[model samples]
Target: MRAIGKRLWMATLAAVLALAAAGCGSPASNGAGQGDANSGEPIVIKFSHVTTPDSPKGQAAEKFKELAEQKTNGRVKVEVFPSGQLYGDKEELEALQAGNVQMIAPSVTKLVGLNPAFQIVDMPFLFNSREAVLKFWDGELGQKLMKSLEPHGILGLAMWENGFKQFTNSKRPLKRPEDFKGLKFRTQAGKVLEAQFKALGAGAATIPFNETYVALQQGTVDGQENTFNNIDTQRYAEVQKYLTVSNHGRLDYVVLVNKSFWEGLPEDIRKALEEALKEATEFERQLAYELDQKSFENLKKAGMEVYELTEEDKEAFRKALEPVYAEFADVIGKEFIDGARALK
Candidate 1:
């Protein structure tokens, strides 16, 4: 009788313990048992990009990281990997898609393969000033472009500026359209840029960003175009001689997050991130111009011959490339081009 009573008690205790264990595994538990809202393990966000920590894009990434952690009250942590520490320009997107990283800010031109509409900003002389660029990007058209990325498992947070592009060459001063004749220029891997340079009677070659400086030095290519900050930071002026302030096109970056990761974020954390993005965008945009000017000053000291175009001179170059609009109309859409042109 004693032995039977003891066995019955042991069985009852086992059943109660099993029920308690099951309770801990309930849906109320954070997915994967990571944590819950009131008390759980902190979330980790890994942001990766391909620029130095001092560049506008890099600075903006750091700013977002700082703000995100602060606003989330330490519940969220953002780890930033700049200068391709995590992945190069070509691999960053793939990493994000695989969920290996949570976020990226790639050059807008890099998105051309995903959606041709992304190259709208790359249209030569498309934006005449910083204000106009901001107006278009912060308005309906920009939002529409960003939304186009959602179906691709990516979410765009904001449009960050890399300032305007200027031309540099070792052959001779490129002050006029005719000056580009027969000169080989390295260009971003975008059809629009290729069309723009070819229209000027110049030869265009697509080279990886990492290989450009050596290419320029060895005469593998005659020249390249990029923002002043890029030229200064990368020390391109050391290899190239003349700098022409073309402002021909803008180099813009789109902040992106893994769509699933973004959507799965706690609602409050997501809102905080969005708010942090807005603040970082403003800081990056303003800092871009300031840094560009400072870079030009530094380049001048480096003995680069800088040239600015007169209104008449600019109009001539603009007229020469007018055919580009018709050539790319099918890819960029005539109506979309018109809409961007019409922005205030």
Candidate 2:
């Protein structure tokens, strides 16, 4: 009878231990998925870009990280590697597609390799104002552009503005299209941009954004074109002799994610991220406008010869680059170009 009682007590103790162990593990083990709110490990997103943290795109990335974490209640983590810490312009897209990083906000011009149709945005003077550019991007044309990337394993989430692009160079003032003659400028990788410089009888050197400063300092390239925010933040004004506020082209970024990784995320987590992006995008637009103005002022204070184009000056540039439209119509799709022009 004593042996029987001892055996029964041991069995009861083992049963109680098993139940307690199961309860303790249930909340974490039985969570929705790896990134579930109750899961022990949070979902990590590695976001990489080629601009400084104080730049418009950089600040917006941080804003997104903040909103994403708050909305997810710590279930999602966004790690932003700005200034090309992980990958430069030439490599970031490949890294995203290969899942090396989960997110990138590259210039739309950088995506010309993915879909030549993207160059439609690079057309000089195609968008008369930033508002028109945003409207076109938020409409059917933008949706169509984003849809074209799915086959390449890329998913476009949103379009963030970096204000209009201006011309900066070490050579001469760029008040007129004629001023660009005999000058070599560092341009992003896109035919339209190359053609724009070519039309002006200038040479185009395709250099990475991070390398533009060194390229200018070493005289590898005479100059480059970028927004005021980019020029001021990157300190291009210090290296270049001239800054032209032509607003000839729009410099914007397309937010991208790996298609497979995005679709595989928990539905709730995806919702949280989308909400975060929407709010961050709104925040970025206003911030971009403010930064552009502030940076313009800073550039003037930096003592670089700054020239703002008059209406007549822009018209001359517009006329000179008309051939670029015809040259790239087939490559970018005539309808896409037509649609974007219609917006203006």
Candidate 3:
């Protein structure tokens, strides 16, 4: 009887020890173990933007999806949503913050509400060429600007170019600063932009990007400003009779990801995505330049009167709108504005 009791006790002890060993080998044991929990499932990244698939931004999003999957060996899956399919210009930022989406590339102008300093990019004639803008974005000032968003649960990865902004008005040709007076223009939401038109003695209306075409067609606004690619893609030429290559401002986007989501990524996955983005960014800029040239020709063929502003004309417009700098210096930071100007 005593021998049978000893055997039973030993068997019970062995069972308990086996259970403890299994727990030690479980997925919660360490970071690698945690990763094992979803090892079979690829991480999904929903990349959202408000541009057509053929646009520079849209193409780059697709390119990123391809490169990311290839680089991560299917560990990462990027699903791109372009042309506001998921969220429009006004709603994308909110969606990213809420984690309903993992990524978005919104125009810098859209970020003014979050940080007024973002308006530095919207300053008229602040950047003369794409190269100068790239220089600014790759410099110390740009690094500081990107870091400014971390406190808001946002991470700005890179600045992508959409080319320079031009004016398209149905009322008349805009060769002179006075040509913009009394005409209301549709503009992205920002105080600097409002002040831009105001300085020219014009009225500015804040309108959603997707709604810009209808607003122009219905004569709700006399004109709007955007890159040539945007003007061509959105068919703004169909409603507006004149296109001025003012190049007064640039329309660039900040590639953003959710702060928490980005930080939580596995180190290997994060490094691979960064490398992929760097390559995609280079491709997007070259595409932007090509599309700008192509779109300019297309707009002319579309029967819109195209006017290229002379150096003198641009200077005149610049002088007229100079007060905008003084008006927002405090809000955008004098040093910040000065830093951008120094780049030029």
Candidate 4:
């Protein structure tokens, strides 16, 4: 009788343990339990940028983050790494291509180095207006340019507006072609921009946007040229004093994802992502120029001197940099540059 009682107790303990295990293994125990109703899961994504959260690019990134999360119904979690917390433009681009970073927001200047066709977007004085740029980018030619990125293991999601590039520095406000003399400015890591700066007789240095603040603060460089949105967003107001309305360069920003990650997404998720990107791009473009104008006004209120260049000055400025086009036409391809110009 004692032996039978002991055997019965052992059997009861085994049964109880089995029941407990089943309960834990079921979807009810955690998110992955079998009975749980969640068909998909939340994936954490790292989105990196080189501007502050207040800039147009930064703000748009924030909007994209919110939209992605909401559209995915909490299935996708996007974490914005604004202000280059993760990496700078070049480093971030490499990381994205390698799948180390899920997404990134880099300017067209950075893309030009990755593919020569991207130089079309960087062509000096090519785009007459934002509408023209949008048309060109959303057109067949733009799609062709985007397709080129696929070979490098990157998927171009959408194009975000970054406004127009202007000149700013601590030394003086640029008012004419002569005003550009000896101005040591920080330029992006693009050949075209560097050529333009050199033509202006300014000693141009390639510095990452993230490090520009500290570099300027330490007197490592005199001043830099970027969009009003970027200048305002990065608080360039704090480090520099003069802002010139040269509007000499275009600021075409791109959002990219890893090709492998993009390809592996389910068809439903992929469609959802495409829709989300389009919505975000449209919203960004509409707000970008408006914010740039606001940033200019805000900079003056912040005690910075602003120079409004005369038409003659603007013409001279344009003339001085004209050689930039011909010089880089070979690398940028004469055919692409001429076609972009002929696009109307």
Candidate 5:
């Protein structure tokens, strides 16, 4: 636990330093240059995300790349960087803020530090199903939340789906609220998740997503939670033995672009990019649903003991964390929670 804490702290510190350095460069050095949309010179957009090239976000990114370039008659070129090649989850946002990268699709919870409202999506068991999630992102609440990012130098283009989070551990099958007691779980760097684990009498630590597989394999943490796609694509099933379909949380990303870069784009090119993003986002959401179902089956085939709880069992877990709603209400707003609950 101490070692994991030390590593996490060091990683956080390094990210802060990188962000500080990012701001040192002039606006011209930040990649805010807007090549003429109608000119022969290609407009280059560097898209960075932290996931496998074959993952939903990766595929959608490629889709956007293909469509954007094709739609513009090769006037726009999107260079895709996947699996943290350009920057890890923590660094990518700072990179985006500094215009080091023109775009990124990081987890929505990753923005909690910028605006606590971003943590609204991380509220445990917030959405009953993917349908509800889609509605939330496409409705007024979604637009309101996206609008919140303007102050932070990011343009929230859309909410891209990952999937529901399921609990996994190597120690034992986690079927009840008590099952989480004393367990150490890896969570994203956010307060809501920390509180969620604490509510269950478990210890939670924030670790970089890319480091979670090894952390679980080496017993740095007893368990972790993630979408089926993340667990399967990252091969976490090999290290963890138990899979509890808690459906306790959702993992989604905010497709973002540097405000400066996006604003500088010619109107026609911006319109084209927005159109491409709309299609790509829908494709990603549909594929996310399919991949999520498929990943669960794949995990079982890979020798995982997967378990799903009854409604009563789910209720027990939900009841245990009920306090989290009020605890975060001030930050996320009671109205937003009420609105979301109305959807369910």
Candidate 6:
């Protein structure tokens, strides 16, 4: 644990003990999963996320909550903290690694910080379509990436969705390469994004996802980029006026639990949770897709300027980002980059 986090934990436990002494809720086993439940105790879990309640990840989490309750016969409870209420991606990830938090849904792009090998998933324009993105992650490479987290004391559940990302701003429509110049943009706290934006001539800063809506609203940035689902659901459209269909970045949101928590669960509960996550992932993906398309229309209805790029319009972006491929060659490696391009 980080030095401050350790102190906070000690303080929190002390406060909780004081509360219990005053006849508050009871404390059970120190371990995470079924161990506490099997003894007729309710195991309440904190599930953290950075997206709004309407994003694919949020829907999946809600479904997981329903299924978990039914499967555990109300023995397990999942309390969701969306919009970074529990912690931001990197911090929540670290907390989960230390078992300070039970679960989180950080962008795969963020995981690259822990293991550079995961950067392969963040190469812009690498995924031709959402179909391709799904295939690659469900195949060998994705499972291999999951194993990467095991060593850090986190366990991977199925991925929900990050709808393909687009650009939105207040300064101007992103019609050409020069239009994006001198623009200050917000990106998720990922090195890959810094390179991606820098390649496009934008001044980019890594910011926590929770702060983005307010940042866009308050004019702290000229523009920011995200999926349609995020902008519409988080009400980013209420603050910003332009939407550009960049489709340049595809995202994957993974569910991770404390490794010890998952391992200690009963086999039956584990299987049910796995089944629930998969079912919810697919359902949320469909809902996000419907919303992603409808958000453009919704934004239009709400008096926003929206632009869908022609191939020529996208050509400029593709060309501008070409250098990013080479710039990250060492981090992601040419072989893996090529493998992704060849995915079809």
RMSD (Å) of each candidate, 1 decimal: 3.1, 5.2, 3.6, 6.6, 15.3, 11.0
Give candidate 5's TM-score: 0.85
Whole-model lDDT values for every prediction = 0.86, 0.87, 0.87, 0.76, 0.88, 0.77
Q: Which stretches of candidate 6 lie over 4 Å from their true place?
A: 1-30, 33-38, 41-45, 50-55, 72-90, 207-220, 234-241
Model 1 collision count: 0
Model 6, poorest ten-residue lDDT window?
26-35
For residues 30-91, write the lDDT of model 2, one tens digit per residue.
11233444567788889999888987789999999999999998988889999989998889
Task: Name the candidate that leads on TM-score.
Answer: 1
Tens-place lDDT digits, model 3, residues 1-344:
89999999999999999999988866441211123314576788889998889888999999999999999998887889898999998899989888888899998878888888988877997777777788888888887888899888899999998888999999889999998889999998778888999999999999987899999999999999998888998999899999998888888999999898888888999999999999999999999989988999999999999889998998998799889988888998887777776665
Better of 1 and 3 by TM-score: 1
Prediction 1 TM-score vs. true: 0.89
User: lDDT by residue for model 6 over 107-177, one digit each (tens)?
Assistant: 77767766686776567777777877777678777777787788888877766676788889987888888
lDDT of 3 at 232: 93
Clashes of each: 0, 0, 0, 3, 0, 0
Query: Measured by C-alpha RMSD in angstroms, how accurate is candidate 3?
Result: 3.6
Give the Cα RMSD of candidate 5.
Answer: 15.3
| lDDT (Cα, 0-100) at 158 in candidate 1 | 90
